[model samples]
Target: MDFDYDLFVIGGGSGGVRAARIAAAEGKAKVALAEESRMGGTCVIRGCVPKKLMVFASEYPGLVDEAAAYGWEASAGAFDWPRFRGHLATELDRLEQVYRRNLERAGVTIFDQRATLADPHTVRLADGTARTAKHILIAAGGRPVRPSMPNAHLGMVSDDIFAMPSLPKSILIVGGGYIACEFACILNGLGVEVTQYYRGAQILRGFDDEARGLIAEMMRAQGIDLHLGTNLVEMAPAEGHPERQPTEFDAAMGMPASDSDAAGHAAPAAPRGAPSGPIWVKATNGSERVFDAVLFATGRAPNTPGLGLEDLGVRLGRNGQVVVDAYSQSSVPSIFAVGDVTDRINLTPVAIREGHAFADTIFGGRKTAVDHDLVPSAVFTQPELGTIGLTEEQAREAHRIEVYCTSFRPMRTAFIDRPERVLFKLIVEADTRRVLGCHIVAPGAGELIQMIGVAVKMGATKEDLDRTVAVHPTISEELVTMRTPVRTA
Candidate 1:
């Protein structure tokens, strides 16, 4: 039963890299990993690292305004996109090198090519070579998918935002998810005219209703033209603009043929690196407008296509996600999958935990399993949102609950006559007095939730929180001081 390696990881993302590193360094097993694109995958390369930097960059203008309100002499200036983008590229490059160095130090072999399942224990690479492993791990992660519509390819995905040659003067962002909302806020903060279209009644659909409502209100106040109950109907390259012509790179990037090209007439390919032109879009609400750019934050799909998993009898979900058990083991005994590829809690931290647990179970002999329940998360909107456990709607359905809620302008903003408000809500089970959920909408909500999450994870009761002393003059102190139930269900 000799094999190429003890374990072969199909992705070099946070999940796959952790598993590979642990198996090699701690488990004392031979490991190897293959990554077609960048070594750090989505989080470091595009998703979180770059996005968070942009979030930081976008916040400076507000900080400058707030500084003036605080009696400090400060003025805002235009953001230089090229300067910031260049720094971001350098940071990403440094991070990728770190990932590679970590894997090498762990004694894991690196393959800079696409890898696919050849058999239960074999992987085929893009270069017509195959390798066998005693165990195979699939953690190829997911990709942002454009909506299936004509001229949709002209629109950029979240990944493309970091690479734009220059910021658009005005942009149309489509979708209601966190990605869409975050970008809407980011672009708006960066001085872009941002129009957001979501077919849903409200944005951040799965979040706490009150928190999301407040966020929607703030987004509009911040000058994002957010239009709920609306969606893009028709889009095309605006006529009379030869600069809007499609290019060979666009075709290679999966842009479909135009109507003229599909009707047996091929349009000339624009030169490489040509700046994209304006897009004319008609919405379902009977409005038409031209935008400098269109960004589709619609959704993402698992990286399963052409992997040859189903052909080898591996079970896959409707969304092309690999189906795995409690320990991340796939239907095939020799195969395993983790991260976004499994469609379970697609957050980067969750993926890392899953990967570590998989390695512990398979190689460390620890038999660890990830607890997916009550995971805390944050959405980095203008005000930020942090939540853990159930939403109020979700908690109300299953338990007799007491909701402790409060909303008011914080001292920092209130002192300056700013209208911004903060909300703190706790959903507690009436009988047990146990906190069922916690949601916060304010600056630093993400940092606040992480500390609060520890208590919630330890099964802290409402009484337990109340007994704790409040940190005076701090907004989070309200978490402990709220004594009255706003409502009981």
Candidate 2:
């Protein structure tokens, strides 16, 4: 059947853009991509790029102090949010332009508007234009969701961080995930009094317990008011409000509070003259505090709402993510989905890989499927966390594993008199000696893990790691030099 284009891709995120560009350029298929927002999607525009830059900016204060200990007179001044934000804005603008230009150069038409499925093979744009295609791909990605609590409207999400008018004098961050911990460190480094409330006993859930625990310790040492086993009771505008009200539970909910319940609380009516001001929050720990801003990194939901996917009989999971097969093909023969919208390995690199594999399979006739295992990921906190392969918990449940772990102050921190310690851990199969996991907690952990990831992905055994000569005096040398298993089971 004749169609407006060979392929119509909805949502110009990393996955959608890659699919559209590849289908058009390589497959010589007619492609049109409709994006409601900017071209680069979450990772490029808001998530990874900007967040990493903020991570870099946040580290300067500590570096200045360390320089002083190294006999260099150095001190950090107040961070200029206006100036740094302006440069960040320019960098984002430049990146968006690059995304648009690349799509255009690849002979793909770009629609700078939201597009949703009208049918298995039809997409309707926001401007009342319906376009038909032989095939459609969904890559709408995800968005940060605000907690549905009383006066939660006063709180901000990850997206709101870049657009903040100014860095708050103090911030109350809610959540135990990477986003919460990352911004807590970032804001604290930027000289804000940052308080973090994670109902979970520890942050960075699903990671190495030892690594995350060390990170929690480091964060506390760095002056983050981290409250474990704590949840919010109620909140209101700090200014022009009544005196503090006692919370119902002196010791509120336990650790790992149900986020859905907390996020769904409706805000009470605000008093008159309650213009924008600080927020007052009562916690599960029976404490009340006023914070200049409340940032909720509680969670992110798939951007599948109102996209017309469900209406067209596209299968959706409980979380509203599109359900797809190994090849990213939807239940509908003519439709497919990838990236965060599919809820399969929601990292940006994974999305790109899925998108590329989908295009190659469908258009290029390569019939490729993305390898979902052992994808490297990092949390860009003050001292970053990088990991690949299985966690020790997963390894132990599945195999007879030997664990090698070490923690010590590095040479750089040695001179600074900082108590900060670095963690290097490995989980290997006891039988085959295959390295099952690699996790690190230190500066540059992210960069270090990328190389380690290659080894782990290659099915490198512990012997292979042992045979490689250690790079002397480097933190990563421990990966090769550690000869004895600390624990085996």
Instruction: Using lDDT, give the best candidate's number.
Output: 1
Best by TM-score: 1
Q: Which stretches of candidate 2 lie over 4 Å from their true place?
A: 241-276
lDDT of 2 by residue, 195-272 (tens): 999898889999999999999999999999999999887876665446533221111211111223456655442221
User: How well does model 1 score by local distance difference test?
Assistant: 0.90
C-alpha lDDT of residue 195 in model 2: 94
Per-prediction tally of clashes = 0, 4
lDDT score at residue 65, model 2, on the 0-100 scale: 91
What are the lDDT figures for the candidates, one per model?
A: 0.90, 0.87
Q: Positional deviation of 338 in candidate 2, in angstroms?
A: 0.7
Q: Cα deviation of 452 in candidate 1 (Å)?
A: 0.6
Residues 1-489, candidate 1, lDDT per residue (tens digit)?
899999999999999999999999999999989999999899999799999999999999999999999999999988899899999999999999999999999999999999998899899999999999999999999998878776676778887888876788788999999999999999999989999999999999999999999999999999999999999999877645554554333333333236346575534432222324477899999998877778889999999999999999999999999999999999999999999999999999999999999899989999999999999999999899999999999999999999999999999999998889999999999999999999999998999999999999999999999999999999999999999999999
| Candidate 2: residue 45 lDDT (0-100) | 85
User: What's model 2's TM-score?
Assistant: 0.93
Give the per-residue Cα lDDT of candidate 2 at 197: 94
